[model samples]
Target: MTKAYDLARDAYAAWGVDTEAALAALSAIAISVHCWQGDDVGGFERKSGTSGGGIQATGNHPGRARTPDELRADLDFAFSQIPGRHRLNLHAFYLDSADNPDRDQIEYRHFTPWVDWARDRGLGLDFNPTFFAHAKADDNLTLSHPDPGIRDFWIEHGRRSRDIAARIGAALDSPCVNNIWVPDGYKDTPVDRMAARQRLWASLDAMLAPAHDPAHLLDAVESKLFGIGVEACTVGSHEFYMGYAARRDIALCLDMGHFHPTESVADKLSAVALSISNLLLHVSRPMRWDSDHVVLLNDDLLAMAQELVFAGLLGRTRIGLDFFDATISRTAAWVTGVRNMQKALLRALLLPQAHLKTAEEQLDFTARLLWTEEVKDLPHGAVWAEFCARHEVPAGTALISSLNAYQQKVAARG
Candidate 1:
């Protein structure tokens, strides 16, 4: 160890925190890097569809992947730059096959390329059934449409997606978290909210009725507060999915950008952990609204890691990134976001959590406040530098220089 890291290590050790254990634990927490970031959520589907979902990636950055191969190459570079082994969160619309099947006709073979790729890299793969940016979803309503035919079509698509996810998980020997998030909502206030929710309830039942090995496939439902057009009401609100997940015994996804600015997802973790068996966190930065900005080492992100580490929820919570900023280098965005998340987790692990809790329990508010603030000024930077060094990844200006070089390499993309 360097003199700096040795001193930092000794300092943390004095606080009754095991820096070595923290580093080891931080390495094990793999953040599922979203594949959509590489291509700004534009999947390689061969159909004319409007990108009219609540989600939209702003700016026309150079080198946005137009093909699955290109996206994979970008992902490969992003993963190489990020420390620790991580999983790729794949969307169904990113299918790679000559069949060019519609959503309803999608099968397992369509994702064979991705599975093979992940297998080769010793990385686990997560799945998402894309329920937006299509002709059927043009109205911002899907799976809960009034027309039975449209609902049936979406239901079949979800069923096939689960099957594909199951096969992928089985192949990789990892449970694939197939998270479902739909844009079924109303721009203006609707009179009959009950009807739409009823339809959605039935569609979800039919879609998830097919039995799959729980060891291979895990189902999760994601909820949103509001989308661009769906400002009045989102069909799958937080309360709706929280109750559903609790009743159905499935995982609930909590996106950092999907809630109001005042809300603290960090506080909800302990409460939600009481109701649900598992959780999937979509870590992102929300700029005033759900703008989906690239994540940074901000207060909210730090609090999230603190909750996970303090509450001992990291084992049951699957951490995934969900942001798409096309204004910057996509690969740089990925590397930055993932590394920030790792950094936050590392900081949490290095905290004297037990002592802080004891202080709180003993009603020693002064000690609690003092200890928390003191950690902020500690030589955590030295420990983090040691971490990046051990992982053979660059930091500070070196990282920026490497990302700039990569941007130049991919700048020729039309």
Candidate 2:
């Protein structure tokens, strides 16, 4: 492995790319792993009847975490196989509450255990207010609901969510990214789109009225093109959130799966970064629609990583995984998604960006094209294996056997 890595290192150095610097940089970037993948998004909150979120996980794979302890244990095993230190992204519904409080009534005390869990592991935390899969969201409107009571209920929930996030960040000594994504829209065309958007703007203003220290909390608004039922129109459209984020001077979250099939989120990164100070990225795979499939080493993912590197926005971007695939081993899904994201970043770092830029600047398009294709065949796998070895994680197909052993010994117990 050392011999292969040395060869690859020399090769990369020939292109003026420092493999050591790349590794060090990659080690510092932490990807936020979502907690819902372990439980199919059925949060710990005790609810009656069916889930009402616009989102849905299709599979009923065995070994789903039944409790917070089990989920944490599963995450422990998953994180062990993945390289680099990562943060955990949590929804409010995942609270460790015995009293089963309503969403609007949730408080910081309910999530202290999670803060302790993250602190113990030396991990940072990110949060989201659960605006879906609840009784209040049954009508498919929240924060933008015409009813003052429903709107007020979600508003309080959002406010408390921000406060809870601040507390968690203060406890962990890291700024928590509190992202708001409301599943409010219509199944068909609405007569009054202006009214719904206007109401949503007001709700957001009220929710964000409370002042919190920027050092401890960063607020972001996420937009979706559509969801399962809200097909025709989504109140929190991309334009709405972009305008809001700019006007409010807050971070705007762009989910890779939350755009049209033809749209490249990679292309939007540079444009949005010009206006927004910070950006939150929910990395997920979209099959046709926003199916939220497990992320893979695909073209779009590669392009996104390259864009970040080219734009010099890697430091300002908050990357988080947002897929929930219950068809496979949950822990394996976590490891694969997180590792692939890291891999994409590593590939981008290994590129000969300087050479490519010089060629383009000199009007040598052919040379630029040649260099791009040439780097594609480089020994990136060897460098990646060396990276895994340095990080003390299973490299190559060894991760497969480790996951199998885990499923048999640990997950099977659940």
User: Model 1 reaches what TM-score against the true structure?
Assistant: 0.99
What TM-score goes with each of the models?
0.99, 0.98
TM-score of 2: 0.98
Off by over 4 Å in 2: 49-51, 410-414
Q: Write the per-residue lDDT of candidate 2 for residues 1-414, one digit (tens) a residue.
A: 599999999999988899999888899999999999999998998865254658888887778998999999999999899988999999999999787788888999999888888989999999999998887898899999999999999999999999999998899989999999998999998999999999999999999999999999999999999998899899999999999999999999999999998999999999999999999999999989878999999999999999999889998999999999888888889999999999999999999888898899999999999999988988999889998999899976788999988877654554
Give the candidate number with the greatest lDDT: 1
Model 1 residue 354 lDDT score? 96
Error of 2 at 210 (Å): 0.6
Clashes of each: 0, 1
